[model samples]
Target: MLEGRSCLIPRPPLSSSGDQESTCFYMRYGIIKEGSEEEEEDEEKIDDRGKRRKSQDLVIASSSREIQIEQTPHERNDYSSVEDLIAPIGRDISINCLLSCSRSDYGSIASLNRSFRSLIRSGEIYKLRRRMGIAEHWVYFSCNVLEWEAYDPYRQRWIALPRMPPNECFMCSDKESLAVGTELLVFGKEVTSHIVLRYSMLTNSWSPGKEMNSPRCLFGSASLGEKAIVAGGTDARGNILSSAELYNSELQTWETLPSMNRPRKMCSGVFMDGKYYVIGGMASSTEVLTCGEEYDPIRGVWRLIANMSSGLKCASGAPPLVAVVNNKLYAADYASKEVREYDKVNNSWITLGRLPERHVSVNGWGVAFRACGERLMVIGGPRGLGGGMIELNSWIPDKNPPLWIMIASKHSGSFVYNCAVMSC
Candidate 1:
């Protein structure tokens, strides 16, 4: 791909009489020629990496010492040369290619000029990635009171995002947060009033999201297509809610859905098998639920599914530690520190395998055990160890005798409460 090719370097004609004349300079690869005075002046505009010092491939000195130097291609002030060749492949394809580029390289690309910055900021590149079936998932977390961070799995590094909106408001928890397309919806509260804040991957900033029809906390949510579904949670009046709603990103609106069969709070929600499944939570102050309800968005109906007791058993105590792999649902058992896959065929819970031992309690507030790609990744910390350190571990269920692999370890004493994956 780096091999030599003949290219034409175009320039304005020397003599101009209110007319445009073009001159073409044909050059072979690996050959450097003395550029025009204007071209030499252009080098000053580029950064040090683009600057090429004067060097001749073959040189003769007055002392009769001949010097041979290796020369590389000179950097150009114009970026259009590459774009002209790339544009013909189609803009959508071009955008997809750009999205596939290394995330760290984005900093340099975005530094090119206003146009490059605008393209990256528009989030269109991510949209194209989704359409092309090449979207990469980034794991985002609210590690501190109001601070949040995203980890690029391919790059295996943290991506800094803008601070949470409204300054004092913090990310609520797993129950109310879900990633819808390129946006992360954080269903948090500004004091007693619940609010939704959307973090846009394209802009790297947070903005106010459409308020939910039923303002609540400790609710269940999940993303399917461009929409997010929110089910049961405690309402503003300190009452449990059965009301449900869907936030459609395309229309930028939230529409009410039929209420669940029963009121529930602090439930676990996941989109699987073409339905939004709301798992166990608190039925009332005196009772913890052992039941679940599945909603068919197309049919607009809720059906009580099997495994009410089995599903709610692990969920009732803390935030539901559930994930999906190969279209099968699984939940983390904090007592055993093992992942249990729900046997839909038999309506039972079976142990998949043990995850990595944790320094933070798996039952800690905001711990996340979610699917990233085909693997289940758990993020939590500071329980068994000191110094507020958080650790990340991942494992694939399909692997023969699944094993937990430690992927990242960061010593930050911040309370990381929730995490979700955003495909962009």
Candidate 2:
């Protein structure tokens, strides 16, 4: 069979003038042909040999049986020693084809050769995919303190991430998670200091996180593309912060942004209409702030909107349960078990419909409500026999009403400690 046969095509090396020569090698089965005007005589000589060899006669007996083909001096210049991702095809075309592949196949593709492993580990493929507006939404959530899992809604498959590094202090401390670019950052505290742990999709491994300009916990954060913004949380020494910082995943650096108008903690952040908004947080232990702040990255300004979270906040509840899909704002009201949509003009919330009947949460603490691409994802489970089940419920916002569909479920603790969505 033709499967037992292989060919290698190599282009000529660059000339002394730093220009690529036009010499090209074309190989099919066990025959090698030169692509240049000077090789016309050689081509005619091969054509004169018995109407060219038949295709079936070119098949090698076995994969280990290497066919001996004659080559010119340039073709024998050890070009195979050079690591090309996919031989015969140029690097640019190979990258384009790799970009079209599903992210789940990256592991298999990386195993092909060192060049492929480097390409996948360097995060270049994701960058190219982003430039082409190609993205897939992966829902990452942590049920146990040190365990995280990813769910692919489109593929209906679950991928368990590498176990987070063992740190007793970090495991016990309250943590926050954000997925920016291909990295998942988990923010928590060490024995006496705040620490950040990072999980990379490219390497499929966890590493120590890069420190932010201002280290804090219980902060409101959201990611858009390769950048993420964290704002208004408590810093060390139990002081509430009004500061904000922007994280660039590509550079793995954080930049200080203009502080918010007011100091607030226990808030939630979301990006809508190309702006970052912080909603429904506690200004103080006794004071619950109903105001929200909108940050315009282009203008470098934060505008305060009064009563923006009037009915969305609860005195003894967790942060506002908010998500954004298609640049539209949504919230899950744990108290009423309802879903609400934001009215941009009125700066108010409109009750859309009820949440999934079995999707239960405690004062918005245990459940995770996030935007997975074009769908709203509710991740939580109702308390049941034994431990409980973790269910992924999804719904697309429409003119009619919300209809949540149970897409996937698993047996686990009902509570979700942290969650984030990575789209790339």
**Index of the highest-lDDT prediction:** 2
Q: Indicate the residue-level lDDT of 25 in model 2.
A: 16
Error of 2 at 233 (Å): 0.5
Candidate 2 on 318-366: residue-level lDDT in tens? 8999999888999998889899999999888999999988866778888
Where does candidate 2 stray beyond 4 Å?
Answer: 1-83
Q: Which ten residues in a row have the lowest lDDT in candidate 2?
A: 21-30
